[model samples]
Target: MAFSVDSTLKELLADERAREVLRKHLGDRSNDPRINMVLYLSLRTIASFPEAGISQEKLKAIDEDLRKL
Candidate 1:
């Protein structure tokens, strides 16, 4: 029952607001697979918590990679 990224994340991919935000940062790179993967994992991490001030070191790392892409 793993939420496999390829098939289970369709709702995240289909969300207009999510796409809009990613597009703002990524431009053409928004559609890149690596960029999407980081975003997907970041979203999963965020959803794991219910409070504010969550440390996002991993997301920061992902963003650094995103910048390289």
Candidate 2:
């Protein structure tokens, strides 16, 4: 399935290509144990959290990559 920032973490991560995009930007944090707790959250929602460290520019980049998939 096609992915976007609005897609839930579980939805995006289900696609290997989308997962790679996340891993590329988020690095090891993409695989953190705590990630399980937010599987239902959209990347957009997570990005809204200051602690998530995903800037608007980064979110756009991730969205672009997901669109390419």
Candidate 3:
């Protein structure tokens, strides 16, 4: 779960606009260890629920893919 969350966070962080926003909010310290930790933690805090309000079939498909991993 942590790896999945961290990977997702890494993807989000790779986006230029998202990185800029973090840089702005963290005041040029987004790369700092404490700030990175806080951001990663908050990413999980704000993440959508597992099912993400999707249909059962879609959820099942996602589950299947996750199981493959």
Candidate 4:
């Protein structure tokens, strides 16, 4: 089963430390959907371990995107 952004954010909110960290970055923003999207994409990119034929250039692009978030 896929772990979605809503589910993940729900889980994160349940943890004091996780919630604190998130609040630090997001402040009191009412934009849960956008925040959830950023968190979800960051987690997905970090979880990826691509195989051969996918060049280093592609990997760097992923890294840059994550850093921007």
In terms of lDDT, the best-performing candidate is 2
Q: What lDDT tens digits, residue by residue, belong to model 1 across residues 6-62?
A: 222344456555444435443435455554544445454543454422245544543
Residues 1-69, candidate 4: write the lDDT tens digits.
Answer: 222222355555555654554455435443544555444343334234352223455545433433333
Query: What lDDT is reached at residue 17 by model 1?
Result: 51
Provide the lDDT at 61 for model 4.
48
Q: How accurate is candidate 4 locally (lDDT)?
A: 0.43
How does model 4 score by TM-score? 0.34
lDDT of 3 at 47: 36
- Model 1 earns a TM-score of 0.31
lDDT by residue (7-64, candidate 3, tens digit) is 4445546666545543433345544565454444434343354522334454344334
* lDDT at residue 60 of model 3 (Cα atoms): 45
After superposition of all CA atoms, the RMSD between model 1 and the true structure is 11.6
Model 3 is weakest, by summed lDDT over 10 consecutive residues, at 1-10
Q: For residues 1-69, write the lDDT of model 2, one tens digit per residue.
A: 778998999999788888899989888576577889889999999999998999999999999998888
Stretches > 4 Å off in candidate 4: 1-7, 30-69
Clash count, predicted structure 1: 0
Clashing pairs in model 3? none
Clashing pairs in 4: none
Error of 4 at 37 (Å): 12
All candidates in order of TM-score, best leading = 2, 4, 3, 1
